[model samples]
Target: MRRYPSLVMLMLACSVAVTACKPAPQAMPVDPEPAAPATTAAAATPAPVPARNECPYPKFDAFLKHFGNEITLQEKATADPLLDSHIDAEAEPEPRKVESRLALADVEWPVMPDPAALAGQGRELQVNTLADGQRQVQIRTPDSSDQQTYTFAQAPCWTLVKREDESI
Candidate 1:
């Protein structure tokens, strides 16, 4: 009877030990379904480009109006007969209206005059662009001579070349 009880206890302990030593079963792997393909068109559409406004040359009327009164006063004092004769001899026969139009085309604002010319004339020219897109040109002639300044409104981004010596 005593041997039977010990044998039963040993069997129960062996069964518990075996169950404790067993490894757990691994879980099965599950894969997700494949994603659908992206749709395609026959051709790729391009975005439209915005149109730019045509930039006109600077308004010469504004320039003339700004400096004309002052220039007229100076011209009376410094009128040179010989230089005037030479200028007239070389001048074109265009009417004042045509000349004004040509001058408009020649005076593209924001352009610096020839540095060499200014140096030769012993003068200094300074240009400044205003916040409102106008350009102000200040010219100081030789020996700090009477300063002449002009403001050209509605100017364009281009280089300007004087057509004649008188144009300067």
Candidate 2:
């Protein structure tokens, strides 16, 4: 009986020792290329183009006509008045919230009309000329009550047109 207990204890000790003495698994090799010093000259990055100050003066009537078609299609597909109401209810009354939620409510991403089609329509496509000569175009929906302002070189063009204003 004494010998049996000692043999079991010795077996346990041997197993523990074998496990403890086992060598740690080697780590997989990694590529050293990323750490290598760059030998070639650093490529020169191009300077960023400054934003244009003027809006593109597109043919407003033609642009609106094209935009209207796109808006109509979009409205037919996913203009959920119920969803709009829910969004409005959850939205904060802040100006940014109103602007973001309502800005596109009435407009869709306008399709770029072909240059030839625009020419056939007898409409000139001029982008809003920024002070820096970059052209931009903005679309305002009829529900927008906020005054939209565009600035060129810190100069402001206030009271351009209201959403209800048909002058565009």
- TM per prediction: 0.26, 0.27
Task: At residue 10, give the lDDT of candidate 2.
Answer: 89
Per-residue alpha-carbon lDDT of model 2 for 15-129, expressed as tens digits? 9999888866664346656544443323345555544333222334343344434634333322222121112334355312222223345543432333335545544433366
Give lDDT per model, in order: 0.41, 0.36
RMSD vs true structure, all candidates = 18.8, 14.3
Give stretches of model 2 more than 4 Å off: 1-13, 22-102, 109-114, 136-168
Worst 10 residues of 2 by lDDT: 157-166
| Residue-wise C-alpha lDDT for candidate 1, range 73-104, written one tens digit per residue | 22322212211101333335642211222333
